[model samples]
Target: MSDRSQLDESGSSAGEAPAVPEWLRRARWVWLGAMLLGLLASVVQLADRETLVAEIRERSPELSQQEVDAATNSGILFTLLVSALTLMVVLLLTNRMLQGVNWARLVLTAWAGFEVFAMFITAIGLAVLGRGTIEQLAGQSVSAVELLAQVLVTALEIAAIVLMFRPEVNEYFRRMRPRLRRR
Candidate 1:
C-alpha cells in the first residue's frame, strides 16, 4: 500500500481510534477503583502499624515490627505502589490511544509483559519471602519495582483491548495468523 494509503486526509491512519471506547472507559474506571483501593490499603496499613507491633509483642514476645508511613511505605506498600504504577500507565495509554499513535499499542504490549514479570516477583515474595527465616530481608522496601510492573501490565491490557478496534493492528495479526486448510 502507498504511504498516503496508510493515513487519511487528517494524516492519522483510517484505523486509528479517535476517542476512548466504552471498554476503555470501564477499564479506566477499574483503574480508578484500584487506585482508591491502594490508597485505602495504605491508610489501613499505616493505621495497623501500632496494632501489628502490639500484637507481635503480646504474641511472639521476641519479634519486632517496624513503623510504616502511608506517604512512603507500609504493609500495603507493594499493592499501593502497583496501583499507582498501573494508574499512570493506563492514563498515558488511554491518552495515546485517543491521539491515534499506533506505536502506543506496541508499548502497551511491552508494558504488560513487564507487569507479569513484576507480579511473578511479588508472588515469590508473598510466598517464600514472607515471615520466614529471612523475614527482615523480605520485609525490606521493594514496592517501586512491582509498581512499575503493574503500570506496564495495565497499559498492556488497555492497549490490547484498544487494538481490537484498530483495523491496522487487526489486519497485521490476521496476516500473521497461519492459514487453515481442510484436508
Candidate 2:
C-alpha cells in the first residue's frame, strides 16, 4: 500500500511519531504493580496487627476488659486509616507517574523506597523477633505463610524501584521534567 493510503484523514502518517519505548511501557506496569503490592502489604499489616491484638487478649485474660478493648479497637482503627491512606496515595502516584507526571514519579520513587525499608524491618521482626517470643507464643511461632508474604512484598517494592530507574524509563521522566528556576 502507498504511504498516502496509510495516512490518517488529517493526512498525518498512521505510523505516528509519538512512540513509547518498550522499557517505559514495562515500567508503567511495574509501577502499577508496585502500587498494588504496597496496598496489599498495608492490608496484610492491618490484619496481622489485628490478630496480634486478639492474641494479646487471649494470652492476658487478667487484663481489664476496658484496657483490652480500648487498645484493640484503637490499634485497628488507626491501622485501617493509615492503610486506606497509603492505598490511595500509592494508586494516585502510580497513575500520575505513568502519565508522565514528573512530580508524581518523584513522589512514588521516594515513597516506594521508604516503604520497602519499612517492610524490610517489619519482615525481620516477624522472622526473628517472633522467634524470641515463640515461647510466649506457645508453639504459635510465626509461620512460613507470614514470612513469605513479607518477602514477596519486599521483593515487589524492589522491583518497582528497579523499573523506575531503568534507563529508558528514567529517560521518559527526564524528557518530561520541568525546568527549575535559577536562584
Candidate 3:
C-alpha cells in the first residue's frame, strides 16, 4: 500500500491514534484541577453579597444606592462571564496540548508565565501596603477559603507547567510534529 493510503484522518498511521504520554496526561489533569479551583475561588468570593455591595459603595462614594446596587450586580455578572470564558479557553488549550499540538503547549506556557508574574506583582503589592491596606480597600477581610483556593491553584499551575515540559512529553510532541504537519 502507498504511504498516503496508510495515513488516517488525524495524520496518524492507519487506524492508530496518537498515544498521550503519562506526563502530558498528568499535566492536563493538574491544569484542569487548577481551573476548577479558580472557579471555586470565584464562587467563594461572591458568597459575601453584603461585602461586595459595601466594597462597591466604598469605591464609588458618589454613587446613589440604586447605582451601587446596579454596579454590584453588573460586577457579579461580569465576573461570572469572564470566569466561564477563562474555563473554556483553558479546556481548549489543555485538550489541544494533550493531542500533541506544540503551539498549544507554548500558549499554555505563556499563560502560566503570565499567572506567575501576576502573582508576584500581587505579593509585592500586598507586602508593601500590608494587610491593613487590603482590608481598607475591600472594606472587609479576605476569607480563608478564597485564599486557600488561590494558593492551591498557583501550586497546581506550577506543577502542570513542570509536567508539561518534561523530556518525554517534549519527545512525544516532537515525534507528532511531522505527522500533524502533513495533515
Return the candidate ranking by TM-score, descending. 3, 2, 1
Question: After aligning candidate 2 to the native by TM-score, how far in Å is the CA of 90 from where it should be?
Answer: 0.8
Give the range of the ten consecutive residues with the poorest summed lDDT in model 2.
174-183
Model 1 vs. true fold: TM: 0.42
Worst 10 contiguous positions by lDDT, candidate 1: 174-183
Per-candidate clash tally = 1, 0, 0
Q: Candidate 3: which stretches are off by over 4 Å?
A: 1-17, 134-144
- The CA lDDT of each predicted structure is 0.50, 0.63, 0.84
Higher-lDDT candidate of 1 and 2: 2
Give the Å shift of residue 46 in candidate 2: 5.6
**Best-performing candidate as measured by lDDT:** 3
Candidate 3 contains a number of clashing pairs equal to: 0
Ranking by lDDT: 3, 2, 1
Per-residue lDDT of candidate 2, residues 41-112 (tens digit): 556655675566666687777888788877777866886787678667777777667666767767867776
User: Residue-wise lDDT of candidate 1 within 63-136, one digit each (tens)?
Assistant: 43333233224435665677577668767875654344445545655665665676677667666856343345
